[model samples]
Each structure stands twice: as structure tokens, then as C-alpha cells.
Target: MHLNYAHATRFNPPCPPSQYAGIGLGPRMKSAERFAGHRQDLARKVHEAGIKNPQVLQAIATVPRHSFVDAGLHARAYEDSALPIGHQQTISKPSVVARMIELLHKNKQPLGKVLEIGTGCGYQAAVLSLLAQEVYSIERVRALHDLARTKLRPFRIANLRLIYGDGIRGLPQAAPFDGIILAAAGLGVPDPLLDQLAIGGRLIAPVSKSETEQQLLLIERVSSHRYQRTALDEVFFVPLQS
Candidate 1:
């Protein structure tokens, strides 16, 4: 179920009248108007790609993408491309995000408490908050976590608890998560995370040599110490810093 971006690298333009709800003066037209426009494009792309969950697409549309990025990049928030969120980290592209969520939901039925490795700009966590019952997100960079918190302030996504620490260790206290999503690329799957997944739980990540081509892995915890795995298509991202 891995989708190689190398083949589907089409980029869409950003929203025409871009601005935040509380921060900016406002959308060019009404907030709903601009949101609808962006929602249509996002939904069309996601639906055509076979994302059946209507709730997922609705979440993509409702989330104010402009709020998740730097103000300078707000204009490109709706575009289907990755934008820098500082700390040498770039928020993953929209298409990739959709693809990951799609694969994450493929076989698993009950998506309960979730652990998110590499909180990044918190955009991914925000999306997870909508999909999962509870979300524990770990971010290596303190400043990045703080910035992401503020960006997601409006949503008051209470289900997401951000932790600034090494994501490689995962969240032990929140172990036995129903699902886990790792945002950064790593050389190998960290054992602590697998130790944390509930039996039959699924964890998704990109594994490969740092700074090189990485394969998306959808691993399921079949027992306390064992896992079943399937490799998806190629992806590239910043190396996970220890």
C-alpha cells in the first residue's frame, strides 16, 4: 500500500485569498468561501486517490492549514507541497499526508489511543487528533513543539498532549497505543515504540538510511514482542535527530 511520490509529484497551487481566521484580517471573501474553495481541491484529490472516509476529507478541509505554517508561507498553505516549519523540518506535503492516513486506516478497524513520533509542526498531530481517540505526540525540538502548540491553539485539540523529547524512545507511559505514526525518517524501527503498541496495533513509519530513500513501513504488533510487516513505496524526509 506504499505510494511512491516520485511518480505522483504533481503540485497544486495555493488558495487565492489566503489568511488565517483569528490572526489575519480574514479570508479574501468570507472564511467559509475560501475554506470551501480549498476544501474542494483537497477533497477532489483525496477522493480520486480512493480515500473513502468522508470524515477524513472533512477534517482536511476544516483544519486551517494556514494556521499550521509560518506567516510568510500562509499563501502556500493550501498548496499540495511541503513547507518549512523551522528546525530544518518541513511539514509533509498534503498528498503524502493523505496517503499516509489512508494507509494507516486500511486494515485496522479500531483506532484508539495513538502515539505520534516526531510532532514536527504539529500539523500531523492535529490531523491525528481528529482521527484517533487520544494522541500523545513527542517532539525532539522544544521550540518546534511550542510553535506547533500556538498554531493549533484555535482548535483547542485537547486530545493531543505534546512532549518535547526524543521520539525514538516513544511514550512509555502511554504504551500499548492502538496506533502510532512516526513523522520523521529513521534508520530502523525503534524498539520502544513496538513495545508500546497494543497487541494487533499498527505503527507506520519511513525507514531507511538517514538522508536517503526511505521505505514506508506499516507494521502490526501481533504479540508483545513480535510484529507483522509490509513495506510501502519510497519516501524522503529529514533524518530523525537523536
Candidate 2:
């Protein structure tokens, strides 16, 4: 049986506050207010860590990251550190996420359409939704894909689409993305991803340098067949899988 696993799940915009009357907005408001401060602090920390892009900081401050992690880990959600999200995968730290997104925005123009190679707990995708006109995220692990959908459903991010499939293969149907980002590290940028990038588009990912060392890599498609690669900061991430 040939099954198409690359189905996309689109989220709708958040419902109006009036719709929460039955649930009582008091608790919800209180929780949001509490997290608002933590988000601001986290953004400040990211700024101190050298993330200068104001829009990137704003996106970090706006997204409710706690919703993407387990309830028990909510206290550490705003910390500048990664947290395990099951299946041996972890969400990227707030600073790292900000840094990568800032790189994508290096051109200082509104992003048209972006592609995320790994959805993880859907944290980065949620943040990208705020910055990009459209975002398509793919996850290879069935459990993580479903988990990302569950975690992201409440926020109702209309611009974000979650797809269950192999991240390594890239989403050919949605190719020619304005920007592409990979959350996991591979030996080098996959050829398909490079081919999927629109001319002048940028792709950022962690590339393994050795068995124990990895570095952030930036690849820009300068023309139809020309690309520029630059090795960046040392980092670590789960190996990109098929």
C-alpha cells in the first residue's frame, strides 16, 4: 500500500475572547499575564546573548513556549536552555532559536514563505508564524508530528502548517521556499534542500564536523545553480534522520 504521509494540518486563528466566556477568562488571563513577564525576561536574556534583531526578540517574547512543553517543565520554559520533548529530541533554546531566525531575517525584509525541517514540539514553527507570511514544518517521527500538532492547536496559528513526513527529503510539493531551516544536524546540507530553495533564499542548519563536533552552516542560493556556504558557531543537535 502506498500511503502519502506528507499530509498537512493547518491551524486557524485564535478564537475571540468572547468565546471563552463559558470557560471564564480570569484564569486564562492570569496565566497569560504571568508568562508575559517571563517571556520579556527571556527576550532580554537573548538580547544580552547577542541577538540584536528586535523583531526576532519580539517574536520570542510573544510566543507562549510553555504550551509546547510538559506542564512540569513550564517553570524552565523561559530559560536559555533546551528541554527534552520526548523521542530523544529537544526543543532548541530560546537564544538559539532567535539567532537562527535572525539570520533568516538578515536581509531585513518581510519573509514570504518559510520551510522548517523539523517541527519538534512546534515551538520554532509558532515563532516563525509570527514573522513569515507562511510556514510549512515537517517532522519525520510520527509521535513527534502528532505531538507538535497537539501542542500547537490551542494557539491557532493560521499561517503555520504541520506536515508529517521525512524532514531529510524536504517537502518537494512545497519547494522553492523563501527560507529553509533545519533543527537537526546532518553531515552537510542535503542536496534536495539546496534545490528547494528559491534563488537568493537562505537555508540554515547544523552540520556535523566530526563525530562529536557540529557547527551552524548558512547556505544561500545566489543563483539557479550557485550557492554560498559559510560555517558558523559550534552547536549540537540530534542527527538528522531519514
The per-prediction CA RMSD against the true structure, in angstroms, equals 10.4, 5.7
Tens digits of per-residue lDDT for model 2 on 8-80?
4433332222332211122334566778888899999999999998888888988878878999999999999
Per-residue lDDT of model 1, residues 1-242, tens digit only: 11011101232211111211222222322453555677568667767766677656766765667777877987788887889988789998766776777666654433578777887887777676666666677787889877776666555454557777788887676677888888878888888888888898888888884455798989988887779999987887778778
In candidate 1, stretches whose alpha carbon ends up further than 4 angstroms from where it belongs are: 1-33, 107-110, 209-211
lDDT of each: 0.69, 0.81
Whole-model alpha-carbon lDDT for candidate 1: 0.69
TM-score of each: 0.82, 0.88
Q: How does residue 202 of candidate 1 score in lDDT?
A: 83
Model 2: colliding residue pairs: none
Winner by TM-score: 2
Question: Which run of 10 residues does model 1 get worst, by summed lDDT?
Answer: 1-10
